[model samples]
Target chain A: MTLNWKSGGVLLGVVFFLAVALVKPIGVSTQFVIFDGILWNAINPDVVTTTADGFTSPNAYLAKSGGKYAEAVANPINYSFIFVLAMMVGAALSVLARGGLSREERAMPELWRSTIGGSSLKRYAVAFVGGFIVLYGARLAGGCTSGHMMSGMMQTALSGYIFSAGAFAAAVPVAMFMYKEV
Target chain B: MTSIILAIVIGAAFGATLDRVGATNPSLIGRMLNLTNLHLMKTILLAIGVGSILMFGGQMIGLVDVGHMSVKAAYIGVFIGGLLLGGGWAMSGYCPGTGVCAAASGRKDALFFIAGGLFGAAAYMGTYPAWKASGMLDDIAGGKVTLGTVPGASYEGLTAISGDLLGLAIGAVFVLVAFVLPDTASRSGGQVQPAE
Candidate 1:
């Protein structure tokens, strides 16, 4: 009776159905790639990836519409980006409605303090650093938890299963190593 | 136009789901990762397990396009990347999907973690050339193969078992394991049932 288990499963089913009704299976990792596009457009507009005739590279699905700087900026605003933005909005609403917005009673401050050492800056830094490393790998590997694990598994793709196995195989040991002090 | 609208609807549901399940709560995730609390595992496994069944089953009835499913190309890099992603998940207590929702739900710390993700993603994108040149990203074993191998299977010959059927069977196990795992209540404010 601790956590509400049924809601998440039901919601995922809903998401899958709606997503199928609208776009392809929903995934969030593409948002990261879009973020990369936005950053690149901001930094160096000329440094764009494209096919021979300057069309958006087919592999670069986000910018499939193809344009110059506008496309670069617009590239990040695809389905995945919208999904991510909505994710924040949805989460915000949930928190507000659920009445658990207190920063004072945040979850797992102790585990974080003990595992990564007690420093807000350190925690933020570790999260960012870890995020960066993880994203790098995720992008290289072609997906993240949602895109690879959830979406792929649903489709019964080997890549999905393989990634899941590899993730747990690595995650358990990493968790063990990181929390060794505890 | 239409895409954004769909995204909004999808995102809200997905995000709310994350919140309801305690998936947005980093502390809850941390406990799950610690292998101490097992409540979240059931939720996660159940979600994936059931998801697989529905997705494939839907395709069977033409409710979903088996072709539209986006499968990542399998390569050695995938496993290597998985390890990195897993390490990051353990360290940050947030995956890209959960992190964004967590941040939006008022987890300020998740924002930082997400910032890290952005930077991490940027690093990878910036070095895309080197990664591709490394040959690790090359598809191995004819990437995007399905788990099943029945005639007319989505991916033919990867295995004798049908991919969707296998997924359904495995997903059932996940649901079983989630229920069977010992439940321990979280010590954190966000604590849930731990195990029996």
Candidate 2:
């Protein structure tokens, strides 16, 4: 459980794919739609009809598809969100197993220190900013990295490639700039 | 029922692996942003390789049905969203999934990222009417098309043959590069301080 890059990368890929193949494809943003669909139906059942199969009716489709106000309150737990939840559990187990679970000082990059104004503050800021960008992009793009790149590419979808390329293109330069000051 | 159970198990495993690999740490991810650590890149590549082989191979052997998968094409949105996401990643050091993982690991900063994301999502919902009226979601044609549809091949053909072959090649390249590359601070040499 040394958590080297190679092993970590391989594990991530394998676990992600297994999740897709065995259950559902890995996506981070799909939760929004599913939640939206459920909520819309719950509030105004008339506005959101239910199919004979127990799925959301066509009336609610727009909210689910477009992620309107009603959709956000309906379903609190989405599949992708659940997947994210699992990822946290997995990460915690990994840390505990490695005996790295204590809340202690960990090494941080210098640029981060300057940006957040404090070591801990920087972590929150980075997460907030990153999440905002990612969620916004997920909304705009209609999917997140796991949905578009990982699962999409697995099925050979053309858009997946485009999204993946874009992600890497952005990730590399930014990563280089931030880490150089470390 | 099976899928849900499987999802929970797999999700836990995925999260654990991310944590073990140091992916839950902002600094580790930041290293990738700075190019000091190619670990993230290598991890992504390897994941792609492994996933391709498993999924495509399962399809080829008739063990899995690839047809049930959903692939939607929101071309304009993906493009613009990607740009914004990349910029944000540069400024912040975490992604949605990693940010959540970081927070779960008791990183206080990750909480900010989570709060920011919730606000952003809520904000998007509140402003949906204007965005929809602005026609940002219109005129989209691409839906579920893959490499197989472009040429003389079918989806199965592309995934089973071309996709599989390419995945293997890419995986091999990653293995080669990882072996040949020198150890940087992010790779093997950096001394990780005991968790606080």
Show where candidate 1 strays beyond 4 Å.
Answer: A49-54, A57-73, A105-110, A114-118, A179-182, B149-157, B185-196
Docking class of 1: medium
TM-score of every model? Answer: 0.85, 0.77
Cα error, residue B166 of model 1, in Å, equals: 3.1
Fraction of the true interface contacts (Cα pairs closer than 8 Å across chains) found in each model: 0.68, 0.60
The candidate scoring highest on DockQ is: 1
**Per candidate, chain B TM-score?**
0.85, 0.74
In the range B1-196, model 1's lDDT, one tens digit per residue, is 8888888988888887778888776666777776767667767777776776776667667676666665667898888888888888888788888888877766667778788887887677557667778898787887867767523444553677766577678767766776776666333445454343
lDDT of predicted model 2: 0.61
lDDT per residue for candidate 2 within B1-196, as digits (tens), equals 5555665688888777767766666666666666665566666666766676676566656675655456657465566666666666666666666666667776666677666766666556556566667676553444446555322223332233465455445546645665555435443357543342
- Candidate 2 residues lying further than 4 Å off, grouped into runs, are A32-62, A66-81, A101-111, A114-123, A176-179, B129-141, B149-196
* lDDT at A162, model 1: 78
- lDDT value, residue A179 of candidate 2: 52
